[model samples]
Target: MQLFIVGLLGCSLVLSAQALYSSSDDVVELTPSNFNREVLQSDGLWLVEFYAPWCGHCKSLVPEWKKAATALKGVVKVGAVDADQHKSLGGQYDVRGFPTIKVFGANKNKPDDYQGGRTSQAIVDGALNALKALVKDRLSGKTGGSSYKQSGGGGGGGSAQDVVELTDDNFDKLVLGGDDVWMVEFFAPWCGHCKSLEPEWAAAASSVKDQTKGRVKLGAVDATVHQVLASRYGIRGFPTIKIFRKGEEPEDYQGGRSRGDIINAALDLFSDNAPPPELVEILNEESVKKTCEDSQLCVIGVLPHILDTGASGRNAYLDVMRKMADKYKKKMWGWLWAEAGAQMDLEAALGIGGFGYPAMAAINTRKMKYALMRGSFSETGIHEFLRELSVGRGSTATLGGGNMPKISSAEPWDGKDGQLPEEEEYDLSDVDLDEEFRKIEL
Candidate 1:
């Protein structure tokens, strides 16, 4: 009996130890004290999980979450918050449930919900998608980079800045061999446009340096002196801008030669080098809230009931959304979807049913404003609506009661081609139909 008691105590101790030790996953453990410094102010992307110790689902998510964290160690920061122990932190983001995953973008205050499957692959896919979206936004001039205001000035005017002077000797070593995205201006010393663009180029170099954390550079070559380099690039004009992407053929800068234009173009180049956006199906309130908080615009689609359309029709709708998303990759907007009647509150609030199935709504949740697509749901029609919205020309409406309608828990898409469930057929061989009908009528 004493031996049995001893063994039982040992087992209890083992379980206790396992429970008390913080997760061994590669994720950084977060608290209110360090959350701001580690996540908010950091430059890279972050995926954080808010969890409770006692919750079985949270416990189950640990292994897969850790695997994802390990896979994305340097590319994306992975973190976990013990929401049960840190009630105040949970309340700040309105985390009402256990095992809530949120993607914190460049903006720390707004976090998008993670509704991907609990598998390791799903988690990694979701993280990469979020990272791509953030990068795209930075490229779109929506939000990001060191804030540098354009001012009137000429080239090489006052202070030396980020643009480096490239001679024939250094051109091959710096521009061709290096991995950073580089913009090289080939110019003659006496060229008037080159002189006029000097100050704007200098200012842009400084901004790009800070924004890209030195992953991109600006350089200038005196075409008169570097004859060989100019010949190699086929530079015909006195002042020509060429973009050098590592391991790829250089592209000519065709945009306007203004400070704003240059900065926008450089940002686009940086984004093109970064990962493109990944689309995820909407499954819950956290996903909806987090998306709204993180993005300048959230495009949500309402599809017809699966029974009505089957897998073919459903897949068709999703394909359209995906293509449009790729076309507007620079917009850096969040794309999500739901069945027409699944989130009735959202459907009603957005008035999605009137236009029929497969309708879409572009929402600016931050301002509680939205614009609907009254046109067809094809690529052309959708493009027209977005084009107008992009220019601030679309008609808008205040969200119901000036608030984003609350979203509820929903089953996430299985990432499979939608196929309608087989319908059940029942037969009644010997029923008194007339008698039953007369009784019901009476």
Candidate 2:
């Protein structure tokens, strides 16, 4: 009997230790059971933290999270999930870290990572900023909800303007010949399932277009109207989706039929087809000009000199930039780095010298505006800096002299440690040092 009582007490303690937030706190404790109803289906903005109770960082964030929740009580919904206990929920949102904060703004299905600071004030500020963006999007007719009712049977809530109409004549040239990845839907006009998917397909098309910068396209064909095209692909169903890549066989789409699912799948295809952005060295005028002009935004990093960081240390910094470039590959941004003092004119133009070595600046070549990174050089810091610029929140300044500065030609960094310039040796054997000293003294 004593052993049974002790076991019950231990179980209670274990259960208690699993939960970090309580009823007294303003944070809403979320689990898989209530997550959909509380967050996904709700119209309001939500800031949710997926955290493990045993993590030291999670523990440290507890008080600040509570404070932020309390401060944002009426305006925003703040929630906490014990991800350690609810692995399914954590995995669903791709929460790989111990403490991951996601902002469920206008689109709950696709949440944005909270990239701001961890303090209560920072948390509150981020939530408010997100709220402001959501409001702005809604006001500009970028409604994210699934409540739009379709009046016609063929079209639903999907944005038809964004969806390319593929016919038998244009199907081969556009889908097969084009270099861009394509998500083509073979649909019949009278089919119920096709009607149901129209809105999702249309919405996904708009999102995919913006996110992939037209690298991935979404197209629809009337299988009933174009029997030859449908027969070639063996489209037997009402709405059969196939992915098309250049020089590759079309693969069947096996993802969910929601807007978010379609967008995610299309993004995956884009990433698979697209190569990582090249991390160029700012060696000359042509190098800098070509890279900046080709991309929507150019990210320039002034790495420490090879002498200071060594090859290993310089490679580490480059690795960080490469990872960030890969992460934001869809943005089609250019990544370039130069050794400190290698491109002094370029550094001065971007205002990089003030921040010292290992600094970063994101420049919009079109606007001739640039934003500097005032954060650490780590992954988390760079992610935060880029995320802020992405949402159009960060402060930007016009490029120096309202134009790109002249890039001085520089030698590329060899993958070796730097060496000091060899000092000139004097042929002093023919001369007398004593006589030279005496002459100088006289």
Candidate 3:
């Protein structure tokens, strides 16, 4: 009887309208162009739906898909492909029916079909179960090559350096230790928001390592499994982020879930110990050579000379650069600055004169490649430029003469107000009455 009903539904043909999803939906709409780039090559897990617009079940699954996608926005990527439109993709994945769901785990080539209830909660549960199994397999030496190398005898999964998985036994020793600040997340496996924050939290941990010199840490506690630790913290909800200062009481982290916001909050804890951007008068030999020697990149800015722009103007410009440096403190890069005319040779080498004062450049010192900022000197423009270079998408050029030029150090700002030159007075004897009258009339 079940086989007969399935066959009847498969054989029935009815024209259905184009499957339109809300524009604000978190589900990534996949096509042939983006399928390979976003799915096949990505390291994260993906739950995809292959649907035909003409099928009734396909239409029915749209709302559930949106819900699950919103719930698992950051942790896992939920996507949909129009099998009716992209016939080749549908054939490649071997889709035999409408609204076919496949879980693309670590290995994109081999995907497992999802067999679960057609409800939002059921879909989320199914996807999470797959993720846990995938993570377990990778940690247990099942995947050929994994992001994390298998270390012996730790019961808990994941690299300690990246994301520390906390248990009841080690919770007190690690969290209430003698030194360092900690950002702990109390979570339950079944919680949707907890799952959504997993990836972002892991990324924030990796980045926070370099920024804070390993003085700040990010750890996760499974609330359901580790009930003792959860109770100690009086955790009434899942996905609670708390800041643990070394000698002070733990405070709740009330910030946005975005990666940038998480990093900002962590840096705020390191305010006293945080390193400031290197402010130099000139790009001297040692200064230029040491900036990017041990780092991936270096951002150098040239500001107007004190004689040209007053101390107040220069200080305001430097403030913008400092704020940006603090924002990206976790990244492995150097933040440096110099006066406009102090390093004439270096300026000529970098072509800073063409862009006028307040010019900037990011250099990959290892590759001897550099990228100049072609936008405003404000925070937004600077962030955009640095982000492009960080992702390896910015264009580059070889250093002029394939080497850095010599420079001499100049005096730092005297902290006194600058004096602008007085306007020149016209000579009455040389003034032409008709020309002056014409200029004034115009």
Candidates' lDDT values, in order?
0.77, 0.85, 0.76
Candidate 3 accuracy as lDDT = 0.76
Q: Please provide, for model 3 over 67-164, each residue's C-alpha lDDT reduced to its tens digit, 9 standing for 90 to 100.
A: 99999989889999998898767765668788999988866655789999879999999989989988998899886232221222223333533666
Order by TM-score, highest first: 2, 3, 1
Question: What alpha-carbon RMSD in Å does predicted model 3 have with respect to the real structure?
Answer: 14.8
TM-score of predicted structure 3? 0.49
Best by lDDT: 2
What are the per-residue Cα lDDT tens digits for candidate 2 across 197-217?
A: 765676678778887878898
lDDT of 1 by residue, 253-348 (tens): 888664456667777776677554566667887777766676778998888877677777888888988888877766668888997777888888
Error of 2 at 29 (Å): 31
Better of 1 and 2 by TM-score: 2
- Per-prediction TM-score: 0.48, 0.57, 0.49
